[model samples]
Target chain A: MKSGDYLIVTLAAIMLIALYVNMWSAPQQAGDRVRIVAEGSEPIIAPLDRDHVYRIHGRLGDSVIEIHQGRIHFASSPCPGKQCIHAGWLERDGDFAACLPNGITVTVLGRNPRFDAINF
Target chain B: MMRICHGAVLALAVIGLAACGRNAGEHSYRLFVFGTLVDITTYDAQRERSDRAVQQIEAAMQQIDHDWHAWRPGPFTELNARLAAGETVTLDTVALGQIRRAAQLSATSHDLFNPAIGKLIAVWGFHNDDAPSGPPPTPPQIYALLSARPTMKDLVFGDGNTLRSTNPSLQLDFGGYTKALAIDTAIAILQRHKIHNAIVNIGGDMRTIGRHGLRHWRIGIRHPQQPGAIASIETADDECIFTSGTYERYFEYQGQTYHHLIDPRNGQPARGVLSVTVLHKDPAVAETAAKAILIAGVSQWQYLAREMGVKQVLVIDQNMQFHATAQMASRVKFEITPTPDLNISKTVP
Candidate 1:
């Protein structure tokens, strides 16, 4: 085959690979967001897709929140129990992590959640 | 105004669908009724059909709430009032069916699941709009009500739907089991509308019809001690899954916990069994059986399950020991199995 045809084949292969990768990994951005509610204040809504820290100025004190790769958690808090961090990752809808001491909470939400009903 | 309302809703629905794109095959509608979240999820390739089906099911739930609410000033309240007044009250067809079923269960269960203890329930402070808080009814307070000993037998089912209570203090309350019937009614409405893929979740107890798409419905039973699910179970097609737990409604009183699951026999919070999960084809049976088994405590749960005809049952007692029926053990996928103290038996001695 000609040199031009070889170059064309390699470019097409790379393009196909890129398209397949984008299609398969797209649901990660399925508009999955988290609602962070600070006690005595309106909720601070943010996207779960982005990796960032939200220092919520709560009534008691500030709470440092973290969102990493479509998952969220209390990276650190001033609360005594540290139960919020122990709650681990907040990745699915209705999953909640709260530092009751500092009066801060994070809840995951999306259109079609994993569980239809949640029992206590 | 009616035409305008219809047109506006149709426009919003169309706009909402277009915004979500054609690939969105699943639709979810969350409505709050019966003082709990009622979520309707349907998997239909046509989004519009899913939306309409959910609307009809939500309407049916609202109707059930209006008709059967126990304490609210509705049909149930009036019936209880009439019965308490010692006057013959004629029940409608719907009321008669529910009352009869409730009465039969109350009788056969040895009053362990009696709804006729409305007065007892109210005296315990459970009749409040929300979960009863601390300072539970004192011993004297409880003894006063216990003296009456209200039972379903107090109600005499005369010819047809006519009913009268011999005990004037007797009051009928179906709060214990009406959610189960509501769940069943919601499923029937969805099926009648030819929508097979749906889930009717009342409060936390739920039932599903058909597959989410090509897979069976999956439910996660929440652990009594934690914030997450302890085990997951794949539901049989059109199966009803329910859980009765102290965590559902309770308050701490000087380190002691007082829950809302009042034992009809003694008129107090059931002493043992943290929670019970029952899976069956009938929603009402699954819920009622779970309640009966939970109140039965660990020592008698196996026998209760047997008498209740519940083949699939999972129970976690106050000691955190996990127990499952052979049938339930085969289906449960424990996220975090309990400690070495696990009971995998048909019955416990």
Candidate 2:
């Protein structure tokens, strides 16, 4: 094959691969960070790109939070049921989980948040 | 051309990697316990630890429900039986503590918030899970009950956790206040475990501790006559928000519906009030005040609120008008703009 033909083939393959990733392999890149909030406290916005773990002192004691590769989840919590931890990873715009006993909640926000707040 | 192809491949890879992740925020969990929704939200980051914490909290709540359930064959039920049989019964610490607190509340509310009217509740078919087939008891039957007038004062509490009742007709029923006590106990448990921020919502009522980040906990007060929430309030730290509505429990008979909240004085459903919501730091007080104020009816509800020293309150009357205390008017942030019927003046209502 000619060099030009080779070049065209390679570029086409690369473009197809990129399209494939966007369509199927990758989850939506919409949400940028996870917002951590506890009652009567300041919000902690954690970057998805920066891999780190936070020890948050909520009303319920310590909630261990982990952020890695644009995903966030509870690593440990003071609540007895561990439901927040079991909720798995939150990686969507406006996705949220809360340990009501601990009085802390995690919500995902992109450039926009889905809800101002849930009523009732 | 080769250079261009290489550049394109590199750019493609960059785009793919850029799309690699998703987003998340505040963590929340919900459980159906105590026959109502127990919704919890937390900001804790550790997944495993959070799960453990939630499981533990749920377990404690279930235990509380089991021990104190009025219809269940548990500790509280046994205590009731012993009291009915005129036996000098020794109550566990939990039951005894509740009795002591209830004694004080009953006295303060002048027995308008009495828990010793279990038979009256049963006569209204509120004690059972099934719906009532017919109308409420006849006037003569209710009159028979009124002759007994079993007040909290009739119950004797002595040393050694022993309890005896002077009135045979008196029966203890904690339905009016058990949920509030449950919330208070759950918060205490969470606080003891070092959870500084938490909310325990049972059925529709709730108690919150600490803050939800920069803001206080926002709770919605359900409308009795309508679908969506009628009003929203920001909960103060360690505050209890309780609402009692005739809408909560009712049975239809002929063309009318009879609610479970019978006025102790009339031996019938409290009239002139549709619902009452109370916001206070003490869950026990809020629960008692909500019931007492509802029984006091519209014109007299303000007196009960003043006597209880409750600052924030909302009362809905039979006329479909809402009355809010000055403190409530200042504190509540309505989800929807107020209409004409939602009047703010207590005196006007």
Candidate 3:
């Protein structure tokens, strides 16, 4: 191939690679993020790979959510029922646990969520 | 010519990948009402139209919440008071119609889905917004209410749609029926607003109007004993999926759990079934059948399901065993690992 033609092909390949990286990086990271939505507060999206305890102040009181080894659950919540605590750990994509009385919820976000909704 | 061909292929690839991204027209609105999280998700809808539909749904829900609340001071409470006083009270058109339909359903399910057990539910301390705590109502308390046998049949309709109860103990709490009614109403509003592809999810019970773009609306059924889903299923358009689980509302009494789903025959929390899910064209029917079948327990659930004309039914028993009808078995993709014990029953003919 001529030098000019080789340069054109190389430039095209680099452009395609850059475009692919720019477009796909966000969603790949997004699939590992867990979203915590509390009423009257902005939703907090954090990485699932990192283990952390998040304190969200909801309507009733503080709800303590913990992420450990790619799974999340309500460690402690001030709601009367404690159904949130009983919900145990949520690991899979589209898995969710909500403290309804406390007005807080934790849901695993992914590039392609497996289900539109969950029925209990 | 080769360079031009390469450029064309690259352009096509970029466009195709961009198109694979999530639909731009999809919208999800979340609200907390009716004592749980309500999610309204619309696909391929204009933002303005979706907003209007959601606003209308919120307004309708507020109206229903005010009118149908059993514990609060509202129209429904007033109706209960007048009924208890033995007065032939004239009910509003909507309430009257719903009560009439509930009565028919109650008779068909043999009163398993009785709304006339409001007094019993109140005594169990489940009628309030806050969760009930500690020592459940005593045996004497339960027996006294059960002795009255306040069935929906006790409600008698008089002239001008006046309702008088033959048994004054017949208090009305439509807890099992109201959420489903609200869902049906929300779907209607969405349809009116020209939003065809949508899902109306009130808490865990929901109804879908159309597909999620190319595929059907798929959902996960929550595991009664554990976190995550026990199964996932694809829901067809205009299908109502309702699940009644003992874990929804409950009180721990001396280490024993007492849930809010009172079995009309015994006046205590229903036992032997952890959850029951039903799929039907009518949300009311689906919800009512779910509650009825759960109360019917392991031995009698199939009988009630057959009577209610519900073909797709899934029941998780207290033992953690899964029982499903043939229709449900065919569609439900069990997600539980180690392959839990699943017993698929014959189709309800």
- Candidate 2, residue B100: lDDT: 86
CA deviation > 4 Å runs, candidate 3: A1-26, B1-24
lDDT tens digits, residues B196-271, model 3? 9999999889999889888999889988876678898899988988999998888887889899898998888899
**Ranking according to lDDT, highest score first:** 3, 1, 2
lDDT of 3 at B338: 85
- Model 3 pairs whose backbones collide: none
Residues forming the 10-long window of minimal summed lDDT in candidate 2 chain B: B17-26
RMSD of each: 9.3, 14.5, 4.6
Give the poorly placed runs of model 2, Cα more than 4 Å off: A1-120, B1-25, B341-349
Span of 10 residues, lowest total lDDT, candidate 3 chain B? B16-25
Backbone clashes under 3 angstroms, per model: 0, 84, 0
Please give the C-alpha DockQ score of model 1.
Answer: 0.16
Each candidate: what lDDT? 0.75, 0.74, 0.86
- Chain A TM-score for candidate 2 is 0.67
Candidate number achieving the greatest TM-score relative to the actual structure? 3
Candidate 2 lDDT by residue in tens digits, A1-120:
567666666776776676666544534543487778776576787767788998888765999988888888899997755757866787765566666666677867766443323332
Model 2 lDDT vs. the true structure?
0.74
Query: Which tens-of-lDDT digit does each residue in B1-349 have in candidate 1?
Result: 5545554565555545544544445666656667655667776536776667677877878888888786779877887787888889887877788888888776656677778778877887777555555677888888877788888888888996799999877887777488888888887777777778778887778888888666777777776876667877777778888999987766677898788888876778998789999889987778888888888888888888877788888889888878888888878887674433456774632
